[model samples]
Target: MQLKSSEETASKAELIWAITGILVVFFAAMLSMNIVITALPVIVSELGGTQIQYAWVLTGLLLANASSTLVWGKLADMYSKKVLFQAANIIFFTSSLAAGLAPNMEFLIGARVVQGIGMGGLISLAMAIMGSIVSPRERGKYAGYIGAVLAASTAAGPLIGGVTVDTLGWRWCFWVGIPLCLAALVVVHTKLKVPRYGTPGKIDVFGVILLVTGCSALLIWLSFAGTPEFFEWISLPSALLIGGALAVIAVFVIVERRIANPIVRLGMLRDRTTILAAISSAAIAPALFSCLLFLAQYFQIGRGFTPTEAGLMLLPVVGGNMLGALITGRLITRYGKWKIYIVTGAIVMSTAMFGLGFVLGADTPIWLIIGALIVVGLGFGAQMQNLMLVVQNTVPVTRVGQASSLIAFCRILGGAAGTAILGSVMAVAVGTSAVAPTNGTNPVYAEATGTLFLIAACITSVAVFTNIAIKEVPLRTTV
Candidate 1:
């Protein structure tokens, strides 16, 4: 009995460290996502990359991220998650170091892909591990910490990236990312002792192969669809790529269905809550990525702010996300309800987006832009993690990682597509101009961004209805 008690105590201590380590990894990985966002313009200028390359920079990371999330999630159920967690950090840290030293646009894009692969694991496993440790009922409170870390990391990334670019050089963003990545790895290596939940089972290698190839081809095709790098949308290359990608997806679905251990159990999505939560999660990605990547452009290139100034100007968004996450998370934990916040967040987010679209122009006041950002941030703060909460609650304890991955996969998939599509749209609208100019007087850029926001507002509205379908279940009290 004394031995048992000591073991239990040690286990509890390990759990605490595990959570801390993953959160640190989570922050580092997510920080990588946005760190380069504000720095893109500078990177582009230095590399002499085209408008399409600009899109590829963000899309590259996002595409790899979305593509690998499901794979990593499934792997979690097959291997020791602690090991996987550490592996992700090593990959991320290595990639970031490589990216910082990239000699050209191609090197940078390739590095982004490697960086994203690591991030996929970090993002999915962090949540999955959280699900492993805490109950759905208490997840909200804990998720608040995740959300705060998320907000802080994401919020600070751009600012820090901008300052680094302004003061040190764009390469320093990736270098800075390395220290955090290293810190997270050290913490996990020493402290985390996550129990193995995976039973003896074969990893569906074929399913993974199909998922990666199909998703990659699809994202690449989407990235170049209407851009000059690829032929016209109606051209043979476009059709073949689209058709071939679709065929690969069909094959993947079939492979997953027949596999004994599918990466994504398609049947699990039959639950209304899971399906709707997924849809809602997917719907928000385009708007989220578009805003996240381009808002900096709008500030620097459209509103005449310097990179550092633009990064600072984004404070409203940071503050809003921070407040929304904390307040909504606590409320959900207290009341044991989640869908209401999700729905409210959707409505608020869309409205705020529409407000920005309508009021924003070449000459819109900066204060108004900041105000809209705050409201949208609040909505995102409320909406983002609760979707994971709902999906995790709906699934079995063993399947939390799977469901959580699905949510992330859908969101990042949407981001990849959105960034590509909107990037092309902006490229066309702006007409062969360097993406950023000092004065922020590009009327065309302003007009195109406004249209994009309107579209995002429309897309986000779909989530409001999807949330209605999210059936609230009794919250689970333990892992």
Candidate 2:
């Protein structure tokens, strides 16, 4: 009995330390992503970059992150996740240092792309590692903690960026997460002890090339379409770009089906729940990323608030996300049901997005805007991690890394695509090369933002149907 008890105690300690390490890595990755939100405007301006370049700063990272996620996910199934995670940490901090030293928008964007490659590993591996260590039934308890870290890091990031921009410099936004990244690396190396499954398979090099090329083509088209200096939406360039991208992606799909060890197993996606979750994730991601990226611009440029004040204004989002995630995670754990929260959250998100569309303006009341932001946060928090939890529960233990990372890849892809499309829309609407005028308040920019939210609302509504259509599966009790 004493021996059994001691084994249990040791196991518990291991679990605690492992979870701690995962959370630290997760927090650092999320912090790196968010810390650039508030400082981006200043960074773009100081670097003499146009609004299109501003959007690329975000899109570049997201594109790389999206493109690399499946590769990392597949690799995690074959390699030691611990070593890969540490390698990713090194890449992220090194690129972050490079980003801080960037003298031009092009260099910063390039560095951000490298950072995203590391981020892709960190994001996918974190969940993959968690799914290995924790059972689905128990995951809600820990997933809530992960969600809280996400919320905390997200909340802290803009504020940190704001303060850093105000005092030290905008470059510090890229630099601030390095210490946390190093700390996470140390913790993960010591505590993460998951076993590797599966033999090393041949990577689908051609498929990766095709996938990246297709996505890059699509995103480039989106970013420049309808701009004065670029091709019009209905032009030959648009048609060729769109048509060529589609052709390449279609080829990628074909290759994935034939490949023995596909980067993204299209067969896995044939499951009803997995496919629906992917759709829901893809649909909702734009709203989440849009709010994070564009709201800062609206607050700073359209409403003429300082970075600090803008960051403070976003606190409602943080509060709502924290509460929504915590409550939903606990409830799902207790009830062993998840579909209800996802459907409800999707509905709430769509509703809030529409509300923002109606309420946002140059002189819109701060209280109304705050209310909308809160609702948006709540909806996103409830759905984000739960979607992955459901998919992980459905898949076999060996495929957890693939399943979790597939969902993440979809989310980032959607965010990247949405940011580009929306950025273009804003540029056209404002009738300027930049999203905002250099000098004063632009009512047109405010109106453009309102339109953007309306589009986001429309996109998010797709998730409501997808989530509602998702068949509920009971949470698994074993890892």
Off by over 4 Å in 2: 1-10, 435-439
For all predictions, the C-alpha RMSD in Å is 2.8, 2.7
Candidate 1 TM-score, true structure as reference: 0.95
Shift of residue 112 alpha carbon in model 2, Å: 0.5
lDDT of 1: 0.82
lDDT of 1 by residue, 1-479 (tens): 11112134246678778778888889888888888888888888778888888888899898889878998898887787878888888998999999999999999999999999999999999988887767788789878888888888878988998898889999988888777778888888898765556675777788778877887777767667776655677888888888888898899899888878988899987788888888888788765566778877777777666778877877687778888888989999999888789889889988999999888778888888889999998998898888888888887667778889999999898788778877877776677735555444566676777877887788788888998777778787656
- lDDT per residue (tens digit) for residues 295-346 in model 2: 8888888878778777787778877887788899999989898999999999
Error of 2 at 79 (Å): 0.8
What total of clashing residue pairs does each candidate reach?
Answer: 1, 0
Judging by TM-score against the true structure, name the best candidate.
2
Error of 1 at 129 (Å): 0.9
Q: Model 2 reaches what TM-score against the true structure? A: 0.96
Runs with alpha carbons beyond 4 Å of true place in candidate 1: 1-14, 433-441
